[model samples]
Target: MADVAESERRILVAVDEGEESMHALSWCLKNVVSQNSKDTLILLYAKPPRAVYTALDGTGRREDPSGYLFSSDILAAMEKYGAEVAVCVIEKAKKMCKDLQQDVKVEVRVENGDPRDVICQMAEQLGADVLVMGSHGYGLIKRAFLGSVSNHCAQNVKCPVLIVKKPKTNAFNK
Candidate 1:
């Protein structure tokens, strides 16, 4: 019994506003989570770093390349929106966990930083047994430009990273 109790795994699932992450969460609940065992599910949402308008870049540019300077009011609204998004995503994930497996324990962590760094740090700090996240499935050019978060975490994290790619639904099905 002690060995069985100690064998329980801590699954860290990265979720966001995207449907891909939600699909990954659903898949983890169905496939990775066990019904008989008391596994802990950690839902992680990485809020992107807040915009900084105080300092100019090394090139002495106050405005971003978009040529739009964000006012204090706009920045505040953006922060508020980010918080709202985190809450909504966490609530949806929790509901899914409860609906699918009521016995399992679910935890949530919302950190501020780049998703790549935040996810990796949380996996190590929390001692996650496995890290599961969705893959945006960006093509070669887009991936090169955007940089894949899953790939970065898979390479950097100590624990095994499961990058779940949400399958594309046929247009006819819709």
Candidate 2:
């Protein structure tokens, strides 16, 4: 039992619907995570919170027939979209592992919250040995305005965080 525990490694990778995130996952599969039965790869996707709709007027009076800001149909569509994104990310990660010929166990987790908070909390809860993510490679001013998820994860996660910066190639640039 102790030997099995010793051999097992939990690697958490943050994935999103972006090329940079996929590149990071591919890099982790090929370089960081080992192809072993005891090793597990966890792909985490943080779905943004559902948009809040308000029907209040200037005097805070209800202005819409429905009390809720968003219609039920809109909420349902948003939920479906989030689910689809999660499914796609999981499938892509699995395919990357298969393409690399790595037989590591894979798990998918989809949570709704701030990406930075969710990622940090998940990494700690999972006792991940390493947390892998990709940098958007935003410039200083852009990052300052938009904020950087990779930067936040690195500072807050308990485990070592690997931020993979995608290299620029002719094919990628075009």
Candidate 3:
């Protein structure tokens, strides 16, 4: 028991609006976190960077593929929406942590940047013992185009990374 108290681990879990991430968090809480020991669960959310749009014709007007101009107000609204999503994700994660284990310590961190970079940076900065996150399970083509955040963090971060894949539910069961 004394050694258990001394061996507290800081587990960092990356969360987002996706159900996959929430599932990872829930799994970590139930399996990795120690109830009798002093363990810290850090929940991290990376709000995407503000969108940067360039005009197709380079006339200083941001235009879509269809040539529809995007106004500054639209950009601002998008940013606001991202912030709101980050807040919601963090709150939901916190609630889940509390519901599962009332004794464990839980910390929340919200950062702005690409999740791949932000999660790695936070894990290093916080000196996490282990990093846990969810895999989106993208196929080869989609992963090639969008890049896998979990895969990038696993390769770059110094700490151990756990990528939890949510089991696919049958449509008929639902």
lDDT of 2: 0.84
* lDDT string, candidate 1, 65-115, tens digits: 444455678778999999999999999999999999899898999999999
Q: Residue by residue across 1-174, what tens digits does model 3's lDDT show?
A: 667666989999999999999999999988888777688999999998876775432454445345446677877899889888888899999999889988889899999998889999999999999999999899999999999999999999999999999998898979
Which ranking of candidates, highest TM-score first? 1, 3, 2
Q: Give the Cα lDDT of each candidate.
A: 0.90, 0.84, 0.89
Question: Per-residue lDDT of 69-94 in model 2, one digit per residue for the tens?
Answer: 55678778988988897888778877
For each candidate in turn, the TM-score is 0.87, 0.84, 0.86
Off by over 4 Å in 1: 1-6, 55-70
Off by over 4 Å in 3: 1-6, 54-72, 172-174
- RMSD of candidates 1 onward, in order: 3.4, 4.1, 3.1
Candidate 3 or 2, higher TM-score:
3
Instruction: Give, for candidate 2, the lowest lDDT window spanning 10 residues.
Output: 56-65
Per-residue error at 36 for model 2, in Å? 3.5
Per candidate, the number of residue pairs that clash is: 0, 0, 0
Worst 10 residues of 1 by lDDT: 55-64
